[model samples]
Target: DEPLDDENLIDYGLDSVRMMGLAARWRKVHGDIDFVMLAKNPTIDAWWALLSRGVE
Candidate 1:
């Protein structure tokens, strides 16, 4: 929400609605994923890497 903020990308920090928004976006491109896994690993670098691998 602020300029040059590093917090947003690193932790995700997405609320229930916001996390759902991301889940929808990922689903559109890669298909459905369990939201619980995302909550367990909320970092973009970590989760995106996992998603890129189509989940392990």
Candidate 2:
């Protein structure tokens, strides 16, 4: 089943290693993106909010 935008990614088997990998990849562009930030709220909406923002 596909996760909803508001659904928790961790609930769908998104583990820390994968999260870190994604954070690392995204950090290349979105410098502020970190594992901790994603881990705090692992949802598509939250990530989109972060990713779409201009780095400060």
Number of the predicted model whose lDDT against the real structure is largest: 2
**Model 2 spans > 4 angstroms off:** none
**Where's the lowest-lDDT run of ten residues in candidate 2?**
47-56
Return the TM-score for each candidate structure: 0.55, 0.91
lDDT of each: 0.60, 0.94
Residue 41 shift from truth in candidate 1, angstroms = 0.8
lDDT of 2 by residue, 1-56 (tens): 99999999889999999999999999998888899999999999999999989755
TM-score, prediction 1: 0.55
lDDT of 1 at 55: 50
Q: Cα-based RMSD of the predictions, in order?
A: 4.9, 2.3
What is the Cα-based lDDT of residue 48 in candidate 2? Answer: 92
